[model samples]
Target: MFHTILSQLVGTAIALFARVVTAVRGVWQGVEPVPRQRVYFANHTSNGDFVLIWTVLPPALRARTRPVAAADYWLTGKLKTFIGREVFNSVLIDRNPQTRREDPIVQMVTALDDGASLILFPEGTRNMTDQTLLPFKPGLYHLAQKRPDVEIVPTWIDNLTSVMPKGKIIPVPLLCSVTFGAPLEVIEGEDKAKFLARAEAALAALAQEVAR
Candidate 1:
């Protein structure tokens, strides 16, 4: 618990810096309290996605929202190691070494069982695409279905893809906007494929709102 709190404090400081930079360069708006238990889905464009989402979350919720990050990336180096273990309280999963992604599902499910909300990128890997409302991996849909009480929130992160994009580190520091659409409810008896498609569509609509 101490580690989690420390991370929240550190995360807040980092976000304050990022938000100021973002506001100066561009407009940063639309940040609000997320509905509890919501699973966030966004297009993966930059390393900045994790920090952006972490900073935007309200102080209280930031304590509980766990970002599902890649183990290979965040688990290795000393700095990555500290951020992952201390501040972010990330659910670092093996995205590359395993033959199957289901391995991460088990780990995430255990976290949810403990009542943690998640900041997840539905795209399993970052792809170079302007329009990236990718077909979400079934795991997100399955998790929602298993725990119907959870609020499945579809979020779109606008400008992060182009602002920092991929393969660049020194965040050009643009105003990255986060749009949270209404929670998606899993209809009773809905199949996996149908549920996943609807969730993707919801995120697309949220992105449209950002564009306006």
Candidate 2:
């Protein structure tokens, strides 16, 4: 009980700090912030990307949303492990296939089964290049195929790369916007390649909108 309370306090403090640093705003262009189960797939640019999204969500939704993050990174240190597991209640997946004990897709589906919305980065890693987005990994496709009922929303996070650049401990104060695009789904009989391509395009389109 004390641990749960401490986790909630820490989570609130983190959200407040993120807002102070980034002045982040949520722009729902294609969907409402209703109480619907959703998979929020965004472009990966910084470690703080999911935090910005979580900060912008309504408190009720934020309570139920979990970020699907890397187990190796979050579990390495004691403080990070506590924050990732207790504060955010993240679904941590081992990115290494050879040493992983469980399938990443099954882990995600289990979270969905437990009625938690997800903040996912389909790129599977931070895009550190000039490209607006890296090609998406197949995990998003498999997740959609497994849970066809859940809404998958394309999210575009702007100005975060500048705010929290690679290897920077202190984030520069910057105005950031998280644009939530329309929800998409797998079409009937859609192949993995085609479905992933369409999902990528949908997310890329939101980036274009943010550019304007």
Candidate 3:
């Protein structure tokens, strides 16, 4: 409760900075809300991806959308720790677990049951690419399979990888556009591979939209 209040306060300040950066650079955001419980999946690129999307989301929806981040990377230091818990309200998952028994689905299922939306990067790890969107892992497909009613929305963030790669500290403000594609629903008896393919295809379609 205290964390949420603090987050709303800090998030507002961050959003203002993002607004100016996006506005001056002519960034256009196309945002739409899904009525049912949904999973927002996007291309992984940079550290800025979380803030960029969070800033553009509507105030009411912002609190509900939790970004699933890498535990090892984002959980370091006091400031990152605070923001991860408070500002982003992210689900810190162990992407590269030493044990073969590691699973994100268990935690994801719990969150969905609690009626909160999720933001996931299907690639599992950040892929710094421009021409091609990475092949998706089955994690997203599994999520959709378990929660078929969930509105699985595929999104593309143009130029984010280039705007700020892993090592770079400063982000070169570009006209980054958040392109949202139509939601991909899991049809009855849909195979996991096909569902995963559709998720990738959906992102590819949106990436092409941004290129146009």
Please tell me which predicted candidate would have the highest lDDT against the true structure.
Answer: 2
For candidate 3, write residues 56-169 as lDDT tens digits: 667787778888888888779998988887788888788766742557788887788888888888888778655477789888878888888888887777776666777988
Greater TM-score among 1 and 2 belongs to: 2
Q: What 10-residue stretch in candidate 3 is worst by lDDT?
A: 22-31
Ranked by TM-score, top first = 2, 3, 1
Top-down lDDT ranking: 2, 3, 1
- The TM-scores, one per candidate, come to 0.86, 0.98, 0.89
Instruction: Give me the runs in candidate 1 sitting further than 4 Å from their true place.
Output: 1-9, 24-35, 97-102
lDDT by residue (1-212, candidate 1, tens digit) is: 88767766777777887787564222223334744676776677777776777777776887788899988889788888988878888988887644546578788888888888888888877757656565678778777867788777777666776666566766666777766667786599988889888888877777776777
List per-candidate RMSD values in Å: 3.3, 0.8, 2.7
lDDT of 2 by residue, 1-212 (tens): 99999999999999999999888999999999998999999999999999999999999999999999999999999999999999999999999999999999999999999999999999989999999889999998888898998999999999998998899988889999999999995597799999999998999999998999
**39 Cα displacement, candidate 3 (Å):** 0.7
Greater-lDDT candidate between 2 and 3: 2
